[model samples]
Target chain A: MARIIQCVPNFSEGRNKEIIEKIVEEVRIMEEVKLLDYSMDKDHNRTVVTFIGEPEKVILAAFNACKVASELIDMKNHTGEHPRMGATDVIPIIPISDVTMDECVQLSKELGERIGKELNIPVFLYEKSAQTSLRENLADVRRGQYEGMAEKLKDEMWKPDFGPANLNERAGVTAVGARMPLVAFNVNLGTDDINVAKNIAKGVRASSGGFKYCKALGIEIKERNIVQVSMNMVDYTKTPLYRVFDVIEREAKRYGVNVVGSEVVGLLPMAALIDVADYYLRLESFDHSQILEKRMFE
Target chain B: MARIIQCVPNFSEGRNKEIIEKIVEEVRIMEEVKLLDYSMDKDHNRTVVTFIGEPEKVILAAFNACKVASELIDMKNHTGEHPRMGATDVIPIIPISDVTMDECVQLSKELGERIGKELNIPVFLYEKSAQTSLRENLADVRRGQYEGMAEKLKDEMWKPDFGPANLNERAGVTAVGARMPLVAFNVNLGTDDINVAKNIAKGVRASSGGFKYCKALGIEIKERNIVQVSMNMVDYTKTPLYRVFDVIEREAKRYGVNVVGSEVVGLLPMAALIDVADYYLRLESFDHSQILEKRMFE
Candidate 1:
């Protein structure tokens, strides 16, 4: 089986179409890399570009995109609701198939070093690629956003993992890491009362004492005239999609509301869906090897 | 996306290990062709080889295997539990992914014509590749088997779709067709009471006015100490695996017997399992395109 890794890089510039296109073009131009999706959130002023390929090709494509981001984006002048640290905010490599997390972590570190040395960007390895336990969480590594970053770097523990011990004035710093594939899923409700959606979201998200890896929010989709429970399943392997959906459905019924429909916003790992299949079918000894298309991928 | 077609060719030789190996080797060595499985049923004296690849490669590999089967086995001397017509009895091309049934039908015709013209084998196109309404069923095409094929072919309605109107005494006749992916699935019952299994099988099979595309049987698995409702889901898209399993489960409950477990005998299309997920999760607006591994397969 071929080693497949996915790279999702978030860039600071979202509203500027031309800049966003230029940054995304790096991934598109890479021979083996597939630019699965790239979307700009004007409100957040951030763009997330998702792509996948062999580890080497993916790292190269990601590095090229980071270089483009560094050249075009100015972190000092950037403003967004989401947390930020650099022109290219964060680049996480996720092992998609036949690739071990250790290998992806190694790839992430190498990619981080290359970006730091060649592009002269300050790098911090977070998540699975973090060198210290204290840096394991991305939020901890990125605690001080761009403006606060210059002062935070002066601390002994906050020394940059690579490149200069200081942040680049214009390009700023970047967080490079390895992570599990996250599924962005949303389910619409029949009720216009956003409280039901909010209550359900709170009951299903990780922080609110629910599923371990689910992060959720209640949002009003005015155009649809309905409320939605938007979620990011951080680790679908642990907290299954079906369980979360089932809870939301059950919670909706308590408020005398029915689930209108549900949708996955972006690509999701196939194994997550296969888990649901195994659960419902009560299949004994079912394997992905039974999937003809899976062998074709290898 | 690459167009994938699966070809499962059945040979009349099974007990002869050397001969079965030679026949399957043709597909094993073909470039871009994946020989997923090849098994010999000694009781039936038949060998079935399953392989998949691009349409052209699969057809070429299947044709090569058929050539090997024709040269090694003589139909008149062949004796087996299973019905037979030729050394290579039947070849069915099934669309796996990114390929349509119409395209598979076209491929089947091309393969049938090539086999007829090159090997001097009388080819009857059955199922979706049938030239007439009367030829659409495989059992109808091979009604007489090898013993009576010579006289059957002489009749106007029984004229072969390709090759000479007369059957070759040594090789007999071959049935070629395009078909949907078939899942060889069996569900075991907690009770060894064969009658309960038999009755449940009748209620779950098409012949007994159950699911439209399901063919089923009840058999005792002596070694396993249980009875099984064995099924061949002819068209998973038309008659999904989960729906049939639900029926069998419900039927088994009526007999006060529980479903012990279920298994898929060989490779199955991924979409078949995904359909189960969609049903149980009650996922709306779900698309196969959202599957990351599916994109990798393409």
Candidate 2:
């Protein structure tokens, strides 16, 4: 099987279309890499580029793209609604096919070191690639953003995992890490009662006593007259989608509210959906290998 | 989007590894064509080669592989447990991505004409490419196999759809057609009672007035002491997998039997499984576009 990895790097400049285009163009030049998506948010002043390919090809494409972003984006002048600490910001490597999470972590560490040494940008490892537990959550490392990084660097505990403690006025610092595929799944309820949705969200999210890897928020789709329990399944393998849906269904039944429909916000691995089918359909022991198309990959 | 089509051709020369390898070698030479799978059955004396690519590239590879099969295989000395009609017995082109069934029908007709004109072997179009309703079912056209095909060729009703009416004593005749992706889905019963399995099959198959596109049969695995309801989902879009499993579950309940597990025999399109997930999860208006990986194709 071919080892496939995906990289989605968020850069701090979204309003400047020229710079975003220039940075994305670098990824398009790689023959083996497939550019999946690139979107700019003016409010956040961030551009997120998604691409996937063989591990090596993805790494090279990501390296080149980040290099261009670092050179063009000036964090000192950057202002956005979304949190940020660097020009390139956060580059996350996700294992898509035969590649494992451990391998992705290793790749992220190697890339983080190279960026620190070659690009002279301070690098902090977050998520699976973090060297310390304090640095695991990206929000923690980027708490003060670029402006406060200079003062934070004076403390040994706040020093970056890579490069000099001194902050780069232009590029700032970058977060490089590896993580499992995250699925953005949402369920809409039939009732217009936003409280019902909020209660359900409270009962099903990690912050409460719900699924461990699930982060959920209830929002009212006023136009549609429905309450939605939007969710981010950070670890689909451990929690699985069916369990979440079933729990919500059970929870909604308490208030006589029914689930109208569910939605998957973004791309998910085939394995994630197959598990749902297996459970709901009562398929005793279903495996992806049974699918003929997967046979081609084998 | 790129148009993608899959072709699986069964040739009658499995025991001879050299001949099988030579024939498969032709398919491997085509650029942009993916040779997904090729397997030989010694007892059946047959080899099924699966491949996919652009329509033109698939056709080129199919033709080249057929030419090699015809050269090495002789009908006079052939014997197999499975049915056989020619050196290259059957070729079915299936639309995989960004392609329609109507387009596949056109491609099948064009390929049929070329095979007859260039190879001089009798060809009959079955399934979606069948000119007449009676010829649509492959079993009807391939009846009596190779030995009886020569005599059947004399009948006006049995005239070849393409090529000479006369059969090649060695190559016999070939069946070419277009069809939807066939999903071989099997559900295992909890009990060891074979009759219970047989009864469940009758209640869930098209011929038995179950699901329209489902073809089901009951089989016993003597060694495992288990019975299975083997099914072929002819058109998954019309008769989705979740519906079929549910119907079987309902019917099995009558016989005091429960579904142990289900097995997907071969490859299935990712969309098919996603449909099951959406339906079972009560997902409203879900689109594959939401998948981040799908953006790679864009």
Candidate 3:
């Protein structure tokens, strides 16, 4: 099976149609890589581009898109609701198929090195690709934003992983890392009681001593007259969907409520859903290769 | 999205390794098409080759493989436990992705025409590709086998669909058609009593006035000390896996038996398992495109 990696890069500019298209065009032109999605948020003044392919092809596309973003998006005049550090704010490489986290870390370093030497953009390795715990979280890496980055770089502990310790005036700085795919999942309750949803979310969220990779919140779906335990599943490989769903089902039963429905807000890995089937059906010796469509990639 | 079709063609020779390799080589060489699987049952003296690709590419691979089978296999000297009527026994075209049954039927006809005209093999379009009710079933089309094919062809009702009325003495006749992918599923019961399994099987099998596309039988798993309701789900789209599973689960409950587990014998369409998730999870507004890997194909 070929090693597949997904790359999601957030660029600082989203309002200019011409600039957005030009930046996205770099990824669109890579024949081997698929441009799964690219959405521009005018409010945040940011665009998130999603694509996947073989590691080499994906890295090339990510680099090309970052190059385009750095050239056209000048940090001096940039303003947005979302926090920012550079034109291409962040690039995260996620291993999808027949790939390992270690390999993705190496890939992130390679990409960071390329952006540092070729594009002259300061790059900080974050998440799984970070050299220290201080840089592991994206919030800490972008703590100062683009404006304070130059002054923050003067600190001995705030040294960039690659490029000059000083910030690039036009591009600012970029954060490159390796991480798991995030799944936006929500489970609805039969009752409209918001407290039930809140209790369940509190019991299941990481901060409340639930599944470590799950970040959950209690929300209301007014149209449906129901409450929901919405979540961002950061690492499905470690904490599967079935386990979380089962917990929510049992939790809802305590309040004489049923799990009316669930929603996957955006795209999720096929393996995540297959794991649900395997659990519900009590499948024996089931391998991912047993999925017919998976054979095409192999 | 590209229209994808799966083609499984059975050839008369199996014991001869060189001959089997030569026939399968035709499909393996086509880079655009994926050779999913190929297995030889020496007892049946048959080799079933499975492959999938775009309609045109799949049709070309099927035709090329059929040509090799006809040239290498001679039905006059063929002998096996399984019944046969030609060198290339039968070709079933199955719609996989972004394709419909009607499109597959047309593809089968195109493949049949080419085989008949170029390879001098009489082709009988069976199943969905049949022109008359009498030829719709494969067993009916191959009733006389290779030995009686020539004599049977003499009758007005037995005329070839795409070739001369007389059958080829060496290669004999071939059956080509379109059909849905069959899933071999088995549901195991916690109880050892075979009657519990048998009753459930009878309740779900089509022959006993159950699901129209289901063929079921109760069997014993001696190793596991459990009884199972094994099934050949002929059309998953029409009779989904979840429906059959639900029926079996309910039936087993009547006999105070709990469902231990289930097994999918071989490769099944990814959609089949996804449907199970959608049903049990009560997924709302879930589209097949929402699958991340599926986007790679699109």
Task: Give the per-prediction TM-score of chain B.
Answer: 0.85, 0.89, 0.96
**Per-model C-alpha RMSD:** 3.4, 2.4, 1.9
Candidate 1 local lDDT, A40-136, one digit each (tens): 9998999999888878999999999899899999887899999999999999999877787899999999999999999988899999899999888
Ranking by DockQ: 3, 1, 2
TM-score, candidate 1, is 0.88
lDDT of 1 by residue, B138-219 (tens): 8888888999999999899998888878888888899999999989999989988999989988998988899999999999
**Native-interface RMSD of candidate 3:** 1.5
Ranking by lDDT: 3, 1, 2
Fnat per model, in the order shown: 0.71, 0.66, 0.77
Encode model 2's per-residue lDDT on A68-160: one tens digit a residue.
Answer: 988899888899999999999999999876678999999998898888898998999999999899999999999988888888888889888
- Which pairs, if any, clash in model 1? none
- How much native contact recovery, as a fraction, does model 1 achieve? 0.71
Model 3 segments more than 4 A misplaced: none
Assess candidate 2 and give its lDDT: 0.86
Clashing pairs in 3: none
- For candidate 3, write residues A79-117 as lDDT tens digits: 999999999999999988778899999999999999999
Judging by TM-score, tell me the better candidate of 1 and 3: 3
The per-model lDDT (C-alpha) reads: 0.89, 0.86, 0.91
- Which candidate, 1 or 3, has the higher DockQ? 3
